[model samples]
Target: MPHLNLTRALTAGVLTLVASQALAHGDVAPQAVDTTGLPAIEGDWLTENPYRAEKVGEETWQRAIEIGASGYNQNCARCHGLEVVSGGLAPDLRFLEAEEYGDEWYVERFREGYTQNGITKMPAFGELLGQEAAWAIRTYIEARPDEGALDDFAEELKAMRDQMEGYIADASGADTEALKTRLTEISAQIETASGAPVADSVAYRAANLIDGSAEAFKSASEVLTIGLSAAH
Candidate 1:
């Protein structure tokens, strides 16, 4: 009788544990995100986001953000929290700025996910959902308001301006027209905005120019990289 009772108790315990695990994750299957009507991203996967307003136009970016918000709610909100807010279970994604610095980590995690003690903490979403959905979700997360984002933007703008000036001064035969135009536009936008919360349009434009220019100007790119890490 004693051995029989112990066996029954162990079976009940296993059932309880299974129930709790199911409740924790809600659904084990990956939620589908509708990426219909979004621009196609070529190749297997992009290391960086290609949905910035500057890269794909404001209209397309708006569409991406809408799809991304819905996708995030369905897939990421359970662990990452609604609107990119974290409730201590996962890292707050709002702090992941919309740049290469954040992109590297986000892409890696989304593709491979995390595991501990042979248990899967985050299941890999790359195979189930393609790059378009991933980039769209990233766009939405980056759009969320963060505490220090504006201050970081201001500092970065100043550094980019200074770097552009240096680049102009040291130019030999490179076509600096595009770089000069971008720098001028960014400086004017920064000067016009006079508060902590910079306007979204201004911020987006500045970030686009800074990111786009990084390929041509190595020094400025380094500064932007360093600035992004510091901001995070």
Candidate 2:
């Protein structure tokens, strides 16, 4: 057999990590995509985005799914789920960025965290995986079928709302202009969701998603309308 080169070896290592992680988190399911007519995995794996490139057209989407699946399983399954679904213990990785934040938000959280509140368990992965590797992981998650572009946009909106709530809480003696900026962003989200007025319970849940006061709760409604509109 031809000897495995360093790149091949690294690719193998990456795949193995995803497989183990998915299995560990109970996210593993039978391959969803049909691989019967797909081409074999081959050649250098480099692409515009290394993480985004799976195995090329032979397997293409399937191969990408596998690599992403495995990588996510290894590094993220523990918290995000076997297949990016939520385990109820941690935020659902599939719908996270899809529902409340954008790629930049996800990237920032990957570097920093949900908030500086010190109450969340999410740890920054900047150290373990260089930015490229992190991006790869993100690509894998994004490739999964669970999240659509709208979902991605919605996720970003929610992140803004959550961030705004935090700002409102800490704004007592803080910068008024900053608060205004946050309000503007929040209003945008509300506009997006205007048609989808949430049920009282859902609205309440949405309200509680971020910590704040009665006044802040009122503000969240205005922002939610913008988010809802944006989503539509």
Candidate 3:
């Protein structure tokens, strides 16, 4: 619950501090994140992530995470790594807390960016993406499962994915409800490094996609396949 506490040092260090010179941040142009389904946010920027499930309801929060995943992968993944995990080139943002303190550091860096030795390591994203995208990305960042949070359930999840794959081939005997229930249980057990109440892990995502339909099973199976592959 502490420096998984990036409050103080982060404000003065973290992304603002030194990094590898070989870092490749790619295009200077920020990618456009489509936040069509999310609620529009305007005016002054918020200090806290307004899209958290508590503030905006679970439905909106989930939507924000979905939209935010796209934004982060496109704009922040090169240095920050996918799912907010860092590769030593940039700060690992997953542990940044979900409170006002962490939010302040994040908003500042995200808006002002950082530079060292005349190189633009982090580009100012506030203008290009706007508030909705910012908060959506924030939501996704805080919802990331902690490193190895799924390790305990890996084998079970793999077996479940295989079962779901079978259901995809033929859904006549699919125990879709059971699959969704088990996935939801696994998701609940996974913890977010940011200390957010819930994590938007693969199990949570796939569980939501499951609805006792062939298309739903296929979609869930694909999510599991990709997420598991990425985990390793």
Candidate 4:
């Protein structure tokens, strides 16, 4: 698989998506999202996402995040903002609650879209993208870490990223397991703005990239570089 090239932990000023904006997303053309590897949704649109960890276990849940990130970047990023961080142009979707109510609200907009006074600000995505892509995108939107989620650890993380670079050059003394464990622990501590179980932050991505190889360290280091750089 090609690299996901996660654009994460952005120091966004606002939300994952907006609720009601006259010029929000209604005008943009909906893009087709590739939902391959994701479990399909059946029997009409779902009121809740089936990709949550508890519903389909961690493996599928993680896949949903991956696929959703791609789908979101392709389809929703224009109005929703890159990395789900609204730049005051649209409502931040990160705060959208992650329960039945939020799910219903998101599905409604995603399916039917929003418009006002004869102008189409958001287009209906139900027919084109299907319920699977809808929920996959939702999975990603809700998993965004709260704004400033990485501020506390930014410098420390930068140091680790630099250390990982050294490991790439000389893999002799690298304690790869310890690095993964530390990153995992940091990932667990981060909180999502939407109250989802996981934040899918840079730490989480970095930890998953480690495999005791130079290439793995290089990839993980790049993930940190992009994520940390965006935080500021």
Candidate 5:
């Protein structure tokens, strides 16, 4: 058999095995989660079943937490983080708790995927992973700590933005010729400090928005802004 044909046959065989396993079991029960009443999961069971925390379960809570931890590592660790710290490709799942959004909010997000406010990177996993498994992952992740590094970076970036805004206001209000000279000098300084392509660094990118032609710059700014927002 040809290599391509062999590869295809192997793929089909593995999928067939998975399908058989799925079909062998009766459908898993849908878990009932009470969003309004509970505090965050803190590495302990909020209920008898930690994984399906809101539902009544025969399984011990520790066993459920274990299943949930394993399930999250398998399905979510890639884009989110190894320990729910966030890899910068997606929003930190920890935000679900710190932001004080409920389990139902997290569950609905996983099931429906976020589309409002122009955010769409998170695709719905409802079809691929059933409801119980999805909720289990959410329950597990709720206990992880906030990734502190990101908060530090956010503060630094905010300071930079404030500085940039001050410079812009000064330049805009002052003498036209002198303002142009100062902006040029500021742009050059930013380019040097950034250590990356001007277009890539946040400071230079924002500086470029100030200096650039209205039409071209605004479009680029929007794209970059949206990309950065999606990452967080």
Candidate 6:
């Protein structure tokens, strides 16, 4: 009976070790990112991010962020950390610059992945994940605020929030174009102040006008809330 008990203990220990390793490297398998909601990129993958809010429109950019967040959580958070905050196992993706300088390296690394000796560090995700999902992840990463990136924009974000709220409160027969314009301006200011891509929450909401109705104002108001909270 003592011998039998020892055998069971050894088995249990092995099983536990295997389980932990699996959990740690579960992202090794390719996870599917749903890019059906996003606009399809034609031809081969572009070397740069085409989903920037200014380039692809805010709604599309927002959709990309949504998909990218899920993709990153599934495939990247294991090493990259949640919300792009790294715990030192990998580089903090949030600090990646939003301009071409960052884009060049990101595209290359994503396409080829990183391998040290015979060990694969980062798996190549371009072909399996597709450009839409990759770009979406990039968009999400670029939008993450660096340390102190939004400090100077706190008061401005608050002011923008107030303006959006006022619009929502008195939205009856409000000029949709004017509201969109104001929100767009605010988004630009956010990008300029942070020196990073505008957060999808702000970019998407600011650009979309839902038929000039109260619903539109409500949506814009919600965007403001999310953007302000993120900035703060």
lDDT of 3 by residue, 163-188 (tens): 98888768999988899999999999
| Poorest lDDT segment (10 consecutive residues) of candidate 2 | 191-200
C-alpha lDDT of residue 67 in model 3 = 94
TM-score of 6: 0.61
- Which number leads on TM-score? 3
**Model 3: how far is 32 from its true place, Å?**
2.2
Each prediction's TM-score versus the true structure: 0.54, 0.35, 0.91, 0.89, 0.36, 0.61
**Candidate achieving the largest lDDT:** 3
Q: Tell me, what's the RMSD of every candidate?
A: 16.1, 18.3, 2.3, 7.0, 19.5, 12.5
State how far residue 229 of model 5 sits from its true place (Å).
Answer: 30
Q: RMSD, model 5, all Cα superposed? A: 19.5
Q: Is candidate 3 or candidate 5 better by lDDT?
A: 3
Candidate 2, superposed: residue stretches over 4 Å from native: 1-66, 96-101, 114-120, 147-232
Q: How displaced is residue 175 in candidate 2, in Å?
A: 69
Instruction: Summarize candidate 1's per-residue lDDT along 1-232 as a digit string, tens digits.
Output: 3333224433443344344443233235678899997998878778888887778887788788789989899889986777565555555666554557567778887888765446666778888888999999987777664445446356656665556545544545444566556544553343211121222333344344443343445555454554445445
Give me the runs in candidate 6 sitting further than 4 Å from their true place. Answer: 1-27, 150-194, 200-232
Model 2 over residues 141-226: C-alpha lDDT tens digits?
65433223235346545655555555554645434354345544433343111111111121332334333454654476455555
Evaluated at residue 230, the lDDT of candidate 3 is: 81
Which ten-residue region of model 5 has the weakest summed lDDT?
A: 191-200
Segments of candidate 4 deviating more than 4 angstroms: 1-24
Give one digit per residue, the lDDT tens place, for model 6 in 1-232.
3333224433543344344323333237769888888888889768778988899887787788888889889888887677676555665666565666567767876878765445566788878988888988988887765555456655754665565566665666566676567556654554421245565435445556444666666676676566657554
Whole-model Cα lDDT per candidate?
0.61, 0.43, 0.84, 0.82, 0.43, 0.66
On lDDT, who's better, 2 or 3?
Answer: 3
lDDT of 5 by residue, 88-198 (tens): 444455544312234545666566664433534456665565554555566566544233322333444454444444444243442334333443454344321111112
Model 3: worst 10 consecutive residues (lDDT sum)? 8-17
